[model samples]
Target: METLLQWFDLIGIVVFAFTGVLAAGHKQMDLFGAVVLACVTATGGGTTRDMILNVPVFWLAESYYLWIAAATGVISFYLIRYLQVPMRLLMIADAAGLAVFVVIGTQKVLALGHTPAIAMVMGVMTGTFGGLIRDILCGDIPLLLRREIYATAALSGAATLVILNDLDVLPGEAVVAIAVLVTLGIRLAALRWNLSAPIARMRSH
Candidate 1:
């Protein structure tokens, strides 16, 4: 389980890094700028979660996450030109990153003997903060502030993992796998269907 979680963490870093590169490309940033953004996006959420939890920051303890983000930046700089639909790619990668990080966050908090409620909050934070930073740096509104099901997906996944943990109905790996799928499925469905919560507005005379 430990090795598996490590792999998911690295995968989340890579996915978020690519999404950051995509945001940089949209902003006409150079390779260095893209790499900086990628590293920030890849690690920002995890860093904040660690600090809040009073645990070691993940990339500080495992430098491979930084290396992967940098490498992904360089590779994406060359490949982005071939991407015909960068927005779609960004959305997909962002969804994937959310799924992976939320699971890791919830698992980390749970392993630390935290309650399910705290785990869910950290899971959503870990899943969303990187994209929040990336979007802000790109001069875009953060998706978490939108009416979409973005955070909902992460929350649902966290709830699933927590409920399954409490129930002890499956192995750790199985529970995690189910939770990840729940997140990814909801996000993908939202993207496919343009599903979102309704906006609230006041009538003005």
Candidate 2:
């Protein structure tokens, strides 16, 4: 079970790294910048999780994480230009990565005997921080900072996982699946509706 979870994490890392590289390409950044964004997007959330939990960083424990990010970045650099529908591809991959990371983060915090509230926050942080970093590096507003439907979707999914676990209605694999589906569904709906943060009311001059 643990091994499967680790593989899921790796998959998420790769997907996010690919999107990061795509974002970098859109910005016309050099190869170095693309790879840097990829690394940040792949490892930033996991790094934050480790620091919060005081655990050894997952990438440091396993070199495969670094290798995967690097390889994905290089591949994306060559393939990004050929992608005619980059935004759609990026959105799908980003949603997949977000869902996977949320479950992984929630499970890790739960294993540490943390409260559900803390676990949910950690789950969101783990799911979104990488994209936050990638956006910052690309000179775009971080999705989390923009009040978009992004982090909200992750939190909703993570919260659901915790709730279902407490009720014993779901176990390991089922929990992850439900979390992923919920997150992905919310994300796609938000995109379809063009949902965004509510507009702030203007003050009278």
lDDT of 1 by residue, 59-140 (tens): 8988888999999999988789786655788999999999999999899999999999999999999999999999999999
Candidate 1 ranges beyond 4 A from true positions = none
| Model 2, global lDDT | 0.87
Residue-level lDDT of model 2, residues 1-205, one tens digit each, is 6886888888898999998998888899988899989988999998999998899998999978988998999998888768664667777788888988988899889988999999999999999999988988878888777756898899999998898889887667787788878988998888778787675789999
* Model 1 poorest 10 in a row by lDDT: 78-87
Q: Please identify model 2 stretches exceeding 4 Å from their true place.
A: none
